[model samples]
Target: MSDKPVAVIGAGLAGLSAALTLQEAGREVVIYDGSDRVGGRVATDYIDGFTLDRGFQLINAKYPELLRLGVVDELDFIFAPRTIDVCVGEKRIALGDPRSNPFASLNPAAGTLIQKLGLVAYLLRTADAAKSVEEELSHLGKLYSRVLKPFLSGVFLTSPASVNAVIGKGLITSFISGKPGLPRKGVGALPAALAARIRKIELNHRIDSLSQFENQEVIVATDLTTAAQLLDIANVPKLAGSTTWYYEVPQELTGSARLLIDGEHRGPVVNSIVLSNLISTYAPDGKSLLASTTLDFASESEVRRHLALMWGAHTGGWSLIAKYDIPKSLPIFAIGNQSAASSQFSNNIYVAGDYRTAPSQNGALLSGRLAAQELLLDQGR
Candidate 1:
């Protein structure tokens, strides 16, 4: 290990993951973040005893990077159901095995058997193709509007049409093969747990220039925009935006832990989950927490009205606890942008954010570890 400490900028998952990996290899590491707290986008705010994540975020229980780090067992996780509910013009239809819910599978709006099978085949075939999801799914017919559009929009934080097809397939496959869940406390708990494994984290300390930390090796692990700004690099990819609203309802609207999608596209709300249904720790006793994700910002009344129409029940009593508008949430990785080997920006300065790899938690952690590995190899470790 080098005598000088490795300075890691941005205490988000990527930065923390890098710091932990480098430290484990006997390198001195120091992490810095502009915010008082860490986790970057994976944040949680406590308002009136309710835990509202910065945006609707979940962890794939089978994420290889997380599993390799052995952090999955450190935090309590609440898994969501394999099936998802889609609201098609006032009817909540389930999407999963027909044997489990035959009526939902029989619904005309669920798409015909041919269409569904075609979509599955296309996804599998193009899992490694360099096509945009929009171009790929457009060939599948009405299924795009009925199920794929609304559901995947919320997942990728952008229209499915614009996201990379292979990335989309990877996300869908991960969700299907692995259990997705939230920490018992909140999504922020994941990074917080990682941060605990490291020492010497300077909070509220933002880095403006790489020159400021003279002699110390620097790792930029912030979002795309911040990383570019700090590194003075141009041509950073555009980012996708998302807004999420957390509502407190007196009664549990959706009794199941399945995520609900807006099949009709009647309103801005794309998908939602009864947070308390997945984990009771999210809400106070006798109260339930409902979270909705949208591409644009919408008022509480607008969301409630949409929810009422979708569930066929009145949501006039639902109270908005917190609303998060993240304009630069996820990086828009084009077809050729998913390269892990190009994380090193220059000598002694490396980049490790979701943009450098896939735009998922696994990507973030993996990129971080890869960046650190590159540095370790350079140091002849």
Candidate 2:
């Protein structure tokens, strides 16, 4: 082996995945993170006899690396029932099964004729595109701009139009196509398992900066904000922002995951509302659990008001398990002039995170793995 070792700079999904890949390839890998804990964004905290995830979180079977790790089986996943309620003004219609529901044929959004035809067109086009998964995702990216955007604006609690088409398509694939399964214990268990398999990890060491070495390789897997701090980029500072709330109620909320629209102008208020009992491990024998998220850019007052609307009457001292702004929770995956960070300095260096381009868990994981594989192959591993 060469004297050089690979250094993975973050312990989140990306960093862990990269480290694991490098380890498998027989590389001497050392993982570093600023946080005391190992799991980065896939955060789960135990509080008041409850497991609270950082934000609205879900683990889809379609996730390639997750499936590869076999952690899904170890956690004994509980499938969330295929359900979503899109609440519009006056009348709330269940979007039914994006796969098998006939509601689209009956109550399409536009005019009656247009809605019906649109529904038919959508189904036909979707069916046709389904033959090729990648093509289907590309097609949905286009539909996101047209159909899903206005509806998802409120669903994701942000402008769907602004979200990256690829990321939006992945979300649609997870819901309409992939099987949804959450950990039996909680999101924390998954990361804990990954950390166990990893070799060397340095916790509580915030990377102050990054400098190139002739033979050793450095992989910067931190979020944009942290990455900026290490790389000395002025624009990286602006990317730091995140908002999320985790609530551990007495018991599981008896229901399916609901996508609640504003019910007014239909602007994004909150993304998908999750019922944690769907994953039995989080809730007690008779209790339920739930977690929701808000945009990082929103002000404190704005978050409070949204919580009032979303929580509605359950605002009592319900054990605020964990609450804080991540500052760099997710990258802004919007259109034009949004933000872009890259590993352009040296061929020996690589950058991987949701901030690199796509801003989703899957993208982050895939980027990490890809960057590692690319580096390893380049080194003739």
Candidate 3:
């Protein structure tokens, strides 16, 4: 029905996936990325003859769209099943394979009572709490007043009352239940593979503003906060902020073991470190990739100081790979909030990104596939 190619802005996983889907459906699609590279947050940098991922990036094994794209086979991936050596002060909790640890089973009542209550509170904020994860707190009623509120604040690094319930539920369903895995080559491989399928990407074409064609359509697929201002769409869903740090540790110092520390850790930084050898083959000859995730409100100095402490305490003298800060890593998905798909705005225009489906390779890929499906359905194909 339409002759004009679908215009996908943002060459992240979502945009690339959407473009590929359109191409597969025998439609012309052109993708534009502001950055010189493809993957937005899902990025990797080649430095000092080593490849380092931006943040602690990983893919879930059960991500359906990722497996469907055929890129999964092209990329080398490894499953990080072990949740061990999660340090909390004196105790090193084995959370990876909790079943393997007899201690966790033996003592159900451990740690501070606040921590115990927090887990119970989090459980109450289950998927069925509201219609959507981004639902307003008012509709949540007692659920927010009693449990959902604080539980999410601690996890997402944002207040539950402020976070949209609809998005929150999506995060819980995708992350809490699913098994998260890492890529062998790096996070960039996933997007690179996706971009490879769609050869019409214009890099360094960061669109500052969109000129809405009267009949032609444009889909702005980006962060909701940014998307709102870009498209002049109000009530664009409220998203909380997040911060992440990328660091590499020497393998001779830290072995191939994964660590995930929660809020109750030390200082303002909720530090979680993972040994690189367990995740990627390109970590380094004798060096391990160490990734640390911190909360949004945390001070940069706090992260740097704590990181130095971690490295100093663990490794006597290790090379600091890079202390890079990612102010925004993951989208804050709250319950009950609904974002009108940009692609749905017009028959010719459509938006696709991880935010639309779920913030991962799976979500990004699915959003693209869904957009293409919408186009095809419109054509009565």
Q: Which structure among the candidates has the greatest lDDT? A: 1
Per-candidate clashes, comma-separated: 1, 9, 39
Ranked candidates (lDDT, high to low): 1, 2, 3
Candidate 1 deviant stretches above 4 angstroms: 97-107, 128-130
- Model 3, stretches more than 4 Å misplaced? 97-103, 107-170, 173-177, 212-214, 234-236, 248-253, 280-282, 297-301, 304-319, 338-343
- Tens digit of per-residue lDDT, candidate 1, span 344-363: 77878888988877889998
User: What's the residue-level lDDT of 31 in candidate 2?
Assistant: 91
For candidate 1, the 10 contiguous residues with the lowest summed lDDT are 97-106
Give me the displacement of residue 256 in model 2, in angstroms: 4.1
Candidate 1 lDDT for residue 112: 82
Whole-model Cα lDDT of every candidate shown, in order: 0.83, 0.61, 0.60
Worst 10 residues of 3 by lDDT: 105-114
Return the TM-score for each candidate structure: 0.94, 0.77, 0.78
lDDT of 1 at 94: 82
Candidate 2 local lDDT, 1-381, one digit each (tens)? 247778889998889888988999889999989898877878877766666676656777667667676677777777765555444444545554645666553554422444444434554443331132233333443233333554454333355545544454445555566667667666767778888998789998776766544467878888776777776767752342445655555443335555443433332245535455465556555656556555536554555455455434344545445665665555645533322344344677877776664566676777788788878877788
Candidate 3's TM-score reads 0.78
Give the number of the best model, judged by TM-score. 1
